[model samples]
Target: MSESSDRLQRRSAPKRLTADDWADAALAALAERGLAAVAVEPLAARLGTTKGSFYWHFANRDALVAAALARWEEVSTERIIRAMETAEPDPAARLGALLRGATLSVVDDPLEVRLLAAGDHPEVAAALARVTERRIGYLAHLFELLGFPAPEARHRGFFAYTSYLGHAQVAHAVPGAVPTDPAYLAAVTAALLKR
Candidate 1:
């Protein structure tokens, strides 16, 4: 083909998908189903693309899984902490806000619970460990700012994190079992923030 013909063909071609696009689709699959659902062909079909698009961004399914996990960690943990820090000025209030938000929110796909169930997978396990530590550490810092000593702060942080995990699991596995009303959320926050 002539150079002009080649240029025209390239210009008319479909836009290439980015790695983030693949990672996001993979994460949606992970959240909806499980780690097992993050296969290349299925995700490609979901994205209305081909396996060639998947291979262009990720070496294999494991790499795609890792990328999805990383995106989840960044979105679910890091950005949340940042938002909490910015949104609340008082430490105790921040902790309470965190509790209320976490408890009252309704998620269609329980990504955390799904990842926890898939914890046996190596990528999921590693990502879970990192997110667990980071979340608990941030909670501990907030507790410390609220006047709790380091050890006490850490313990309370762990307790708070576990409470969130339990809430997520209950909300996902058995909807309507846990009360998500404002009164219930307030009670839970009051109990958690009790000195």
Candidate 2:
């Protein structure tokens, strides 16, 4: 083939951005700037593409939003739970790791904070409910394994989840209000796990 023809072919073949690519970009926009910023044009520009590419993958903005929320639920909640269950055998140690990780990574990971802010939307609310239930249930199971009665286990799980939510709010809304130092995090985790 001629050099010019080859160049033309390459230029005409726009990058093939997959549906997952668009979905992930939408989630990032949602996390960084909230649900309003997940619009196609904005995400297309962010991905260095055009609306045509977005439409090629998603049917509409609502579809894209649904995909983004599903991705968030899978990545943020399900994956973490799976990893915790597989990687740690001891309930106490798994709980400690979870509590410490959640506390320490608050500022660095604000997707949950962003989602909570947008929870009024139907899709966001549904996803939030599912994740909250799953997380709290898992925490409760861990507490149960640690020998707490069912009711106490459930309450502790709720408390731990709420504590993380509060800590995340402080860390995200007012930096430096919550100390994420190693010692501080360890102390907090120990306190949570204390019988």
Candidate 3:
């Protein structure tokens, strides 16, 4: 092909994967095969690229893992919280929505379970702790807004969080076991909130 033609072809080709892309692929790998599966070579293959592409964005595997965890935190916790707050003005409704949203499992996004399983890693542990605290704190605040005392709110928040975690674990272990019906979820929310 002529020089101009070659240049046009190259320009039209897909752009190189960004660090975010690599991190996303790493998170997918982590979800599919646990933490150990998040390696440079495998993720590169998963992305239909090479290690060179990964190395361009990350210094090493650990950096990639950290990036993936950070991305998870942003999407799973921060963004969810932001969306929840904006979606509902009432604290009680927001809390119910959060619980319902959390219980609905997304097949492609099972990173929470994977991360909890791999929580021994310092990065995973730290991320898990941050997310757990953030979620529980928000829940507690909602409970307080609903007229629960500070200690009682915190206790209810912890109970709600543990129930969530347990439900997630059970859902993962036994598909279709965790009820996703709106009525069931409403019942769960009402029982948890004691409303």
Q: Pick the candidate with the highest lDDT.
A: 2
Candidate 2 wrongly placed segments (more than 4 Å) = 1-15
Q: Give the alpha carbon lDDT tens digit for every residue of 1-195 in model 3.
A: 899999999998977899899989888888888999998887888898888998889899999989998999898889998998898999989988898888885422577788899989999999999989998998999899999999999999999899888888878888777778899889888887884
Instruction: Report the Cα RMSD per candidate.
Output: 3.8, 2.8, 2.5
Per-candidate clashes, comma-separated:
0, 0, 0
TM-score of 3: 0.91
The lDDT of each candidate is: 0.86, 0.89, 0.87
Cα lDDT tens digits, model 1, 158-192, are 99889888988888889878887788878877776
In model 1, what lDDT does residue 173 have? 81
> What's the CA error at residue 191 for candidate 3, in Å?
1.1
Return the top candidate by TM-score: 3
Better of 2 and 3 by TM-score: 3
CA-RMSD of model 1: 3.8
Worst 10 residues of 3 by lDDT: 103-112
What would the per-residue lDDT of candidate 2 be over residues 1-195, giving only the tens digit for each residue?
999999999999877899889989998888889989999988999999989988888899999999888888888888889999899998988998998887887778788899999999999999999989999999999999989899999999999999999999988899889987788878876776788
